[model samples]
Target: MAGVYFYDNQWFEECPKLIGPTDHSFWLGSSVFDGARTFQGLAPDLGLHVARLFKSARSMGLAPKETETEVERLCVEGIRKLPKTTELYIRPMFFARGGFVVPEPESTEFCLSVYDAPLPEFDGIKIRFSAWRRPAQDMALTNAKAGALYPNSSRALREALELGFDNAVVKDANGNIAELATANLWMVKDNVASTPALTGTFLAGVTRYRVACLLRENGIAVEETTLTESDLCNADEI
Candidate 1:
C-alpha cells in the first residue's frame, strides 16, 4: 500500500525496528496503540485520539517518548506524505523496546503509520452472540487500550465468523451486552437510541462517544444504560 511510517525521528515506507525478542512488550504484551482516519483533507477528532494514545501508553506502563503536539505533527506529516486522494488509517503506536521482569516505561518507543485504506460501502450486516464474555474490571486492564485485551476479542470474532455472521455481540462478565467484537454497541428502541453504559468491560471508543454527542445535540435522545443480549435481539435497530 502507498503509505509512510515515522519512527525514531525518521519516516519509512516499511515498518521500523521498535522491539526485540526479549522486549517486555513483545513477550508480555505491554503495548498500546490508537487510530484515527484521514479522508477528504479532514482528520476529525485527531487531538482526542492522540490524547487517548498517551493515556493508553501510561496506563499500560509504557512511557511515550513524544509529547502530544509532537505526535500530532508527526501524524500530519505522514498524512501529507501520502497521496492526497487516498484515505488512510492513521495509527500511532507505543511499546516497550527493552526490559527485564516487567516492562520499563522509559524504554518505550513510538511509531506513526499512515496507510491507504478506503472506507467500505455501508450495508446491513449480521451479528451473532459470541461464547466469549468481556472480562470484569479486575480481570483485565480494560481501562486501557492495550494490545493484550485483543486476544479474547479475536476469539469472539473467530467464533462469529465460523457461525457465518458478520460480527459478534459480546457480553460483559455479568452477562450483560457489552459491545460488538470490534466496535461499541448501540440499540434503537421505539426510535430512541441507547448503548451500554461504560462498565469497565470494554473500551469506550472515540467514535461511539462522538456519535452519541452528535445525536443528542441534533435533538435525538440518546441513553447510556445497561443492555442485555435479549434487548439487542428484540430491538428495532442495532
Candidate 2:
C-alpha cells in the first residue's frame, strides 16, 4: 500500500523527504487538493477531477504544472502500477512555496499520489445537524477543499460521532445545508430529487455530478436550490 510518489518531475522514494517545509503552506495552511476514483479499470469523470484540481489550485494561487491530459495520464499510470483488481483513492495536491506567508502562485509544488482503498459504498448515511457553521465567504479557503478548511469539518463530524450519528451535516452562515462531512447529499421526495445549490460554501462532488446526470437522463426532476434544516427533517428519505 506504500510506494514512491511523484512531485513535479521527481519521485519521492521516501515521503517528507523533500526539503523545506519552508513553504508557507506548512505554516499558513495554504494548500488545495482534489480526489477522484478509478474503478473497474475505468476512470469516469477523471477529466473533471483534473479540471477541478486546476481550478482549486488557481483559487489557492498555486500554479499547476500539469495540464489536464497530463494529470489524467499520470492517474492512469499510477493505477496501472498497482496490483491488479485494486481499488484506490487518487489525490493530487498543489501548494504555494513563497511570498509573505500569504499564498501566491509563485514557487508552487504539484504533487500527485495514489493510495490503495475501497470506494465508499454506504447504503445510507445517518446524520445529525451540526451546530458549527461553515466558514464565511470572506474566509479565504471556505470552499476550496484546502487542507486548512477540513479541520472545521473534522470537528463537526467528531461531535456528530460523539452524539451517535453516522455523519455530520454542516450548515453555512445562512443556516442552509452545505454538505455532509465526507460526501454530498441528495434527498428524494415525491418523485423529485434535490440537493443544495452550490452557494459557495460546499464542494459539489464529481460523483454527485454523475448521479445528477443519470437522474436527468432518466426523466427525473432534479432541483438545485436552497434547502433549510426543516427540509431535511421533513424528508421521507435522503
lDDT of 2 at 138: 80
Among these predicted structures, which one has the highest TM-score?
Answer: 1
| Candidate 2 Cα RMSD after full superposition onto the native fold (Å) | 2.0
Each prediction's TM-score against the native?
A: 0.96, 0.91
Question: For residue 182, what is the lDDT in candidate 2?
Answer: 76
Which stretch of 10 consecutive residues in model 1 shows the poorest summed lDDT? 15-24
For candidate 2, give the lDDT of residue 12. 59
Give the per-residue lDDT digits (tens) of candidate 2, residues 127-176. 89999888776864665778988888899999999988989988888989
In candidate 2, stretches whose alpha carbon ends up further than 4 angstroms from where it belongs are 2-4, 12-16, 19-21, 120-123
Evaluate model 2: give its TM-score.
Answer: 0.91
Note the residue pairs that clash in candidate 2. Answer: none
